[model samples]
Target: MIPYVRDIKFEYGAVDQVSPLIRRVVANNPGPFTYVGTGTYIIGRGEVAVIDPGPDIEEHLEAILKAVEGERVTHIMITHHHIDHSPLAAPLKARTGATIYGCAVTKVVEDDGGVKTEAGYDMGFKPDVSLCDGGEVSGPGWTLESIPTPGHTSNHICFALKEENALFTGDHIMGWSTTVITPPDGDMSDYMDSLDRIRVREFDTLWPTHGPPVREVTPFIDAYIAHRREREAQIEQALAAGPSRIRDMVPVLYAAVDPRLHPAAARSVLGHMIDLVRRGRVLADGAPGPDSEYRLAG
Candidate 1:
């Protein structure tokens, strides 16, 4: 069965009660990457916990304040340090004195001679309280357990709401599109591992930052894992057939896909090749970059 995605017609500051435990206020920033803007989630009743405050847009900040007008926002949590996710955390913290929580700054790996990709970090963000895997934070009637599912970004985390049996999946998982896993920071190996991590967990639903909630948890997880593995197989086959460069493989592998999307697809292919090289399945001349040549390992 296909996942049922809720169509949210958001008006900047309006608060929509998604469930008894959750209210969502979407920021105005919408795009291909962010389906209908960032849905800043307000969890719990009186003393709420705000997750992914979204971009630094002042209007978004005002909207959150209005949503929790009479209630106290005790905790502010970030899924990752990307510009669209963590920029507003500082303002929310200052206004409510809410304790900010998130994973520490992303750790930069020594460039493996691969194409160096920068996903633009929010360098100013420093969580007042750092959350590690299995850490718990509570407010009013809800408790969220931090699941460090790093892949979309080195510091990405998903919060599992204990009361709702739902996971607040950051960009690590989204309903609208497959995640962009650029290497050095975004690891295909780690991304696949994280998907497997979530597959084993007990969650009935997922609340992603961008689009609607995912209801078919197990099937969606299974399909996502299978889709990526299939993509890897396609890349390996292409390599075996002699498409040595990413640009060359793009047309061969992504012929049916939009030409405009090929550039991004090429990056994903590079990430897969890097992982393949690490696993000894494929060989790259140097670090996996657009210019790097690849071949099946003998």
Candidate 2:
């Protein structure tokens, strides 16, 4: 199991202090992918840094503005350019004059397979300061180190709060569920490498944008990695029978999952197939994709 944390106590639009140096204001956007909604985090006091300002709903914008009413928002940090995560940054920046930092927008736009309607990428998002892996940004009392973990999206980056030893994992390692790796931009090879990268880091806690905090950090990450490996194993087993399309394998691979989510599951399976093809473990008819047929390498 992934040691999922589902229950979070918070009223929408109200700022709740989650830790000594961190406070969260939940946006009123909830769904299958968003869970309760986007938990926009405020780091440090007085001169603070806001992480994932969330969607562009007027209420959400007002909530964030109210939360930082008397404080100076020195920095606006984005994890990725997803519509839910980065759309509010522009308006927030206009209001606060804060420098936007984090990953740049992905240039390539592939068929997201209906996943875009739920949580699409915000192509207009461009950071004033692009922080690569090991980059650092600071405020009055908090310093966040950028840990680029680009499996969820090519530009997805996690911010680590040095003072609290807490990592703000965007969609890379959500506590509520496994991340959806939609390809072309979302790669399984890169995602697995990113997982291993975070696994070695001794972080005290993980705060995902969409859900509550993850306290048992190491075990949670271990289980996440194991789950992916298990899925890969299942794919391998399925391939032993014959060449198969991602859509064909999704039903058997994700039988327990909601049928509504099978499309997303197929995209994840496509991610695995891309990785398998790269590693020479599986052979694809053409470029590995959602519609491509695959078989175990001879």
Q: How many clashing residue pairs appear in each of the predictions shown?
A: 0, 0
Q: What is the C-alpha lDDT of each candidate?
A: 0.85, 0.89
Q: Taking the tens digit of each residue's C-alpha lDDT, what string does model 1 give over 1-298?
A: 3354657566777999987899999998887677788899999989999999999999999999999999999999999988789999999988999999998777754535533233356867789888955599997789999999888888889999999899999898887767889866788899999999998996898999998888888888887888888999998888777648888888989999988778778888878888898899998888777689899998
Poorest 10 consecutive residues by lDDT, candidate 1: 110-119
Question: Mind giving the per-residue lDDT tens digits that candidate 2 earns over 8-65?
Answer: 8999999999999999999999987799999999999999999999999999999988
Error of 1 at 228 (Å): 0.5
Superposed Cα deviation of residue 288, candidate 1 (Å): 2.4
RMSD of 2: 1.5
Return the clash pairs for model 2, or none. none
User: How does model 1 fare in lDDT?
Assistant: 0.85
User: How far in Å is the alpha carbon of 267 misplaced in model 1?
Assistant: 0.8
Candidate 1 lDDT for residue 123: 67
